[model samples]
Target: MPALVLAAAQTAPLAGDLSTNLARHLDFIALAARHGVTLLQFPELSLTGYELALARNCAVTLDDARLIPLAEAAQRHAMTIVAGAPLRLGDDTLRLAALIFGPDGAIGHYAKQYLHPGEDTVFLPGEAGLTLTLDDDARTRAALAICADTGHPEHPAAAKRSGAAVYSAGMLLSVNGYAADTQQLQGYAREHRMAVLLANYGAPSSGWQCAGGSALWDENGEHIAHAPANGEALLIAERRADGWHGRSISLD
Candidate 1:
């Protein structure tokens, strides 16, 4: 298998500002393109800033016209972009979802299957895990999970059972909660023998002081790369013949 370059982005999206947030996403896509990143993942609710109260109004469908720019960017750069947003399922239901856009177009979505206690009030949990084949070689299969989903051992276990070689999560971990959260992520990588990637918020949003340490772990559970907790950053990891090589780029 050829080397696969992936990035985990730490960003601060403006609350309820879809246009501004999408513009910010475009900027990140452009940056990732320059670095030869094939896959780029953003923090949970990155489009709408993790504001539950505004989620209903901000919710969008997979075909929402507002996402055209992102699709075009992905196609132009030959990159796959995974961005989080509240998704409207029906007239009255919404799910916290990660929208996947590839070089062709919108590919698929992963709705949060396990919700945090606070999330239950605003979003519905999905029933299945989402997995995607990253390339034609079919050697890189990635599974998606949301914030609280990573806390459950069964979630990653199920992903492993489904043939996923990589486990990726989009989350908004608070400053004080990052240590425990990251420890669990490393454990998942070690136990499941799957490469792990995490994207998180870089600045305060929805009244929480977010921890900006987006990171990646190798299959052996070694920390490959990690962004700083103080500013917007991108952690990139490339799988090589020897192992995974990684670096962090400051975006602030």
Candidate 2:
């Protein structure tokens, strides 16, 4: 079998700027393509920063035409792209979501199951978990998480029970929360024996100064790759015949 290459795009999103952020996402997709990445995940609320006040205005449905370019790029590159956004649920409900664009142009989404403190005011919590099978291979099942969801031990534990081999999270981690948040992810990887990946914002969003330490850990919980604390970068990890290897590439 071919190696499975996965990456985390640690981006610096502009607050409430969808057009500009879309362009940046395209650039990141192109770059990931050049590196033969098969799966790419972006930080939480990557499409419009973590600005709660603008979520409703920025929320998009699954059929939103604004996402056509992203679906097209996914098909063109044969890469599964998971980017964060605010999803429009019912007429007035909004949820923090991860929009998954498959290489076949099929769009699937995962709403964040856990909300941090004040988030309930703006977004509804998702009810179920989603595990994706990559390239029709059973060996590459990936489970998705968003921000605060990772803080709950049962989240990853349930993913493991669901047969996920990879646990991926998209988040906005401030400097004060980085250490504890990452420690939990690392523990999940070791405990569940699943490769873990974290994609965090590289700049401030919604008034929070984000810590840009996006990273990846092998199934054994060995820290394989990491970006610096304050810059845009791509954290790539590939599972080869020998083991999982990783590298950090500056996107700046």
Candidate 3:
């Protein structure tokens, strides 16, 4: 298969501001397109800034008209964009989910399988695991994960079992928790023999001091690229003939 260029974005989303966030996402999409990124991922609850109190009111269904602009951008760039949002399940149930918009349109949705400290009160856990094919050869399968999901050993194990070669996680990690979470993510990459991509917040939101540090790791568990913990940036990784090479691009 050909080399795949992937980008993980670290951003500061305004609380409860969906339109502004969507516009920000579009800007990121345009930048990714300029860099020839095949896939782009954003942090958990990026659209609503992790405001659990507003989750229900902010939840969006798959058919929501607000997503039309994202769909059009995906089609225009021929790229796959994975963004986080509070998703409405049935009539009243809400889940923390990664919404994927591809060149073909809305391709897949992965609800967070694990919840953080107080998230259980507002979000329901997902039942099924999700893996998306990134290339026509079907050799590059990517798995979706949320903040707390990276803390569980079984989650990545299940994704590996499902034939995932890349593991992507979207998170909101505090300054004090970044070290531990990064160690755990590196361990997952080594144990599963899969490339890992992580997206995190760059500013305080929802009453928490966030640590950005968006990063990418090779299959051997080597740190390929990392953004700083205090700024908006994009970590890009490309799988090449030699191995995976990565770099961090400033979004500011």
**lDDT at residue 164 of model 1 (Cα atoms):** 95
Q: List the residue pairs that clash in candidate 1.
A: none
**RMSD (Å) of each candidate, 1 decimal:** 1.0, 1.0, 1.1
lDDT of each: 0.91, 0.92, 0.90
lDDT of 3 by residue, 1-252 (tens): 479998998989999899999999998899889988888999999988989999888889888899989988998888889999999976678889999998877645899988877889998899988988887778888999999988889999999999999999989999999999999899889999998999999999988899889998888899999988887888888998888888888886
Task: List runs of model 1 lying over 4 Å from the truth.
Answer: none
lDDT of 1 by residue, 31-116 (tens): 89999998899999999999999999999988899998998998898888899999987576999999999878765688999998
Question: Candidate 2 residues 80-174, lDDT tens each?
Answer: 99999999975868989999999999998999999988889999999999998876656779999999999889999999999998998999999
C-alpha TM-score for every candidate: 0.97, 0.98, 0.97
Candidate with best lDDT? 2
